[model samples]
Target: MNEPIISVSGLRGVVGGSLAPDVAMRYVAAFSAVAPAGAIVVARDSRPSGRMLASAVHATLCALGRPALDAGVAPTPTVGVLVRRLGAAGGIQISASHNPPEYNGLKLFGPQGRLLTAAEGEQVLAQYRHSGPAWVPYDRLGGWQEIEDPLGPHLDAVLSVVDAGLIRSRHFHVVLDANHGAGGALGRRLLEALGCRVTLLGEAADGQFEHPPEPTAENLAGVGAAVASAAADVGFCLDPDADRLAVIDEAGRYVGEEYTLALCVAHVLADRRGPVVTNCSSSRMTADLAQRFGVPLVRSAVGEANVVSAMVQCGAVFGGEGNGGPIDPRVGLVRDSFVGMAHILAAMARRGLPVSRLVEELPRYEIVKTKMTLQRHRVPAALDALEAHFSGARADRLDGLRLDWPDRWLLVRPSNTEPIVRAVAEAKTRHQAQELCDQAAQVIAALG
Candidate 1:
């Protein structure tokens, strides 16, 4: 079997090839060993392999004499919130996120309802490698129970963060494309709670997606067309786990994920002025918003846990990533598609502007992303060349190498899941963004 891709967040791989039943069992047991002594919340996405993997996790938790609270087929953020609501030791979400259907993985969350910090995750990883599962005797075996209302707390949490009554007054016509992931029900409930007239695409949470589940521009052309045909005020698209979101205008234009954070930051800063945090790989729009609002915008290493740690340390009012993850601390530390939807709709309601107009108000930048297969050993050389080539610009080595200017920026980071270096650039125009990415790719290729 191929070695599974392991990280501080969690592990993922092709089901039968790398992530088999035994592998899942061992990993869950490893997590169980280090987790606090309390019930563990377990949830899965809509993928078929989710059930198989979840069963292993449940059995392992039970065998270790830890009670397992199963939240069946829910979004990843829901599990995060549920962990804190239930006062459990930690939580595990069975999902591969936006990866292809054949892939599935697990994401671990701490008791505070956030992804585990790097230090905590390293302890789990070390325990998994050095120790074995301590299965309990028959008399000490634990039990299992299914959660009756997993979505209720999550919905209430999101509603509390936004003015639901104001959103309801507008009665906005909205389209939601969940792509048959675990978010269908929650997405519908959130819109209905806000009194929006919602039209759902792929309402069934059967893991059978109508299109690719990433919510990218090219992959969601059909959804954009549907939004235009329905004449909806806005469209929201979610990934398989519903942690990421992308926006579509009434005219069927894809607003992409980067704008999701910018719009939410705008709405958040309108009412509260405090620090904001985003990953190093996120777009510069948030930085622009922070400056416009006269607030500090702190950039962290590229991960949800890192962002959450920074937010907690800085007491940030809003934080998220460029990949459509808007993390409102009032809601939960995890990236939440529901939070994104509420904030975007609330922004529209408050401004009385169309989705297109709301997007137009924000600073716009063209972002281009590309990746190249490069061995780990060559990464340092590539970074050296990139730094020397762009010596005129300010450099940031937080996660990888990020070079920045007043109007443009370039990021080169090695993938946590794949053996490739990803290069991303944003500028005033598409041509400039593409040129930056191409130039970085050339430098990496020359290292060969």
Candidate 2:
């Protein structure tokens, strides 16, 4: 039997092969057994498989004597909010993130509307292995309910963080590409509320993607051209689940996802100075902003849960990942694309500068990423060889092998699921960044 790839926060796998109804039910039962007895909020993206999985999740929760509160199709972050708002025991989001359509997964949240910590996640895993849910008596089975306006409160909370009035007055022309995901539901409302003359692409919530769903520069070529042709001020593209976001400048240049967090941090820090947190893989521009504002910046491992954990520990006002996941403490702990959009628009409106100019004003850096195949057992030897080759560079094993230079850095780590060593570098120029990755790959290859 195929097994799902379960992690601390949730599980993900290819549909039909590894992610069948039976496997999903078992995990749901495990989660229900461990969670406090209360209504559990459930939401999903616009994936074709989401409806089927949602039904399965509901059945499992009901059978375990836990009421299921369905939020229907919504972003992952929205599910987190509804969980807190309705006082649910926890929440489940059905999304594979930026993975292909063939892949789908479930993300679990705690009662406080946060993803489970490492300790809490271990408890759920143990329950899954043990395989016994404390089912209530036949007369005490949990009930089910549906929520019609899950996005309303989320929209209000996001708008409160930014100057909606100012953004509306600017009358900016905006282009939004939802790619037929759940984002279209709220993305349209947020844009309209901001009073922008909006042109939407792939607005249907049908899970039919016009292009690849990741929102990377290469995949956003059509969005770039649409921005230029529409003569809009900027373009926004969201992944299949809407948890991640990428931007295109007014000039039709893909500014990339790395700037999503940096741009929002710059805006927030300009008004209020406070601590910021991000994963180790985030760009150095975020660090530069913290330095300019004299605010502390903390780094965590490369994951939303890690970043959120550090943010709470450090009392950070803002935190996110370089992959377009911006987490605003005011909104929720999860990375929210809607918050990023609202903040960027508010910043542009206040400064009265074009999106292109605003991007140019910030510190710039280039990042190059590459991966190499290696057996899992050989990772230790590869790390030793890499450290020896780059003897002059400062070495740190916070998450993996990280070599730091005065103005550049390279991170060599193994993929969580694949048998490949991932290498990432950031430098002052694109060539320099690529060179760093190439040098690391060459050193690792020589060891093999």
Candidate 3:
């Protein structure tokens, strides 16, 4: 807790606490050290600390003699798209994603427009802990420039994957809850391009969040009512960095994040039969869809990097985590909220169904998540005990301990960003899911 959570995935910390200008600078320096010989695109979400961190990151890049292509206040996926479109060596997004405002962090992208793989992250971490910044002299210092059109490439890429003409023809009304994160500008543009009559909430690209920024059911409770009040056809709520999405139907129903990927996957696979990938901790809805489509369902460990790695291995056409991030390979290889909104609207326009009706077509399941704080050394034994306690169920140790049954499942994994263990369960009903988590909790508690 005293230090930022640094990993290959990214670095996140409390703005004034574990995260500061120097921390941001050193992390960027490490990235610069390993990045290829080209400019590095830097961006941030609409957090207050983002301005401070962006300054330090640009300074670090310039000091290291790496040109800083600054795209101020863009979505996470937009940063990725800019990196590839601009032909940069890499990209860095200064946002803590769905974390609270007090938290801000960096997410790295490779030249391929994907999050740094675990191996690539290890290389970066080694530089951070072991090497000092390679400061340059005055003559060799790097330069900085601002990008003029950050959202255009990202918007065009997302619009390309969906039927823009058909969606525009529907002229559906939409409610966008950006919650003052970096999603508003690009999200608004994408919706307007699709010809949606927009009721945009928290449209400002400031850190002034009206609600919590995660876009969960609890965080987005008011969005459902807002959607109904606007008489909109659908509501799309985006997380802070705009990589994830959560939906609300016209009936004021929170269709939830898990359904985001499932809905998009089902829609894509209905037309194109290719392998689909999701994380192990995601809902079984994706697995069911892959089965229904007679395609392979590949479950990677829980992380965007892991999912992308699995996707590349399987050549998955459509993939995402359970967290409302659907990845269409046609778009840049990142978890994109724009991709979700466009595809969901296209699904509605093509099928002539409401968001809720489209949701009903998919098989339903309930998911429950709980956590416990245990020392790091005890984790393996704890998982072993849970595995033994649920001997009848199948177990998988891909990222953590996962026990599977026909209709329900439980996953126990250590938090990569927090000092706790997370246990998730899903089943046909909420009670069934809760019971599974409770059983797992008892097993994990008995270990202590």
lDDT of each: 0.94, 0.91, 0.92
Report the C-alpha lDDT of model 3 over 169-235, residue by residue, as the tens digit.
9999999999999999999999999999999999998899999888878888889998988889999
Candidate 2 per-residue lDDT over residues 302-349, each given as its tens digit: 888899999999999999999999999899889899999999999999
- Candidate 2, position 12, lDDT: 94
- Give the per-residue lDDT of model 1 (tens digit) for 224-252: 99999999999999999999999999999
User: lDDT, candidate 3, residue 366?
Assistant: 92
Model 1 weakest lDDT span, ten residues long? 439-448
The clash number for model 1 is: 0
C-alpha-based local distance difference test score of model 2: 0.91
Using lDDT as the measure, the top candidate is 1
Pairs that clash in candidate 2: none
In each prediction, how many residue pairs overlap at the backbone (N, C-alpha, C within less than 3 A)?
0, 0, 0
Task: Kindly provide the TM-score of model 1 when superposed on the true structure, using C-alpha atoms.
Answer: 0.98
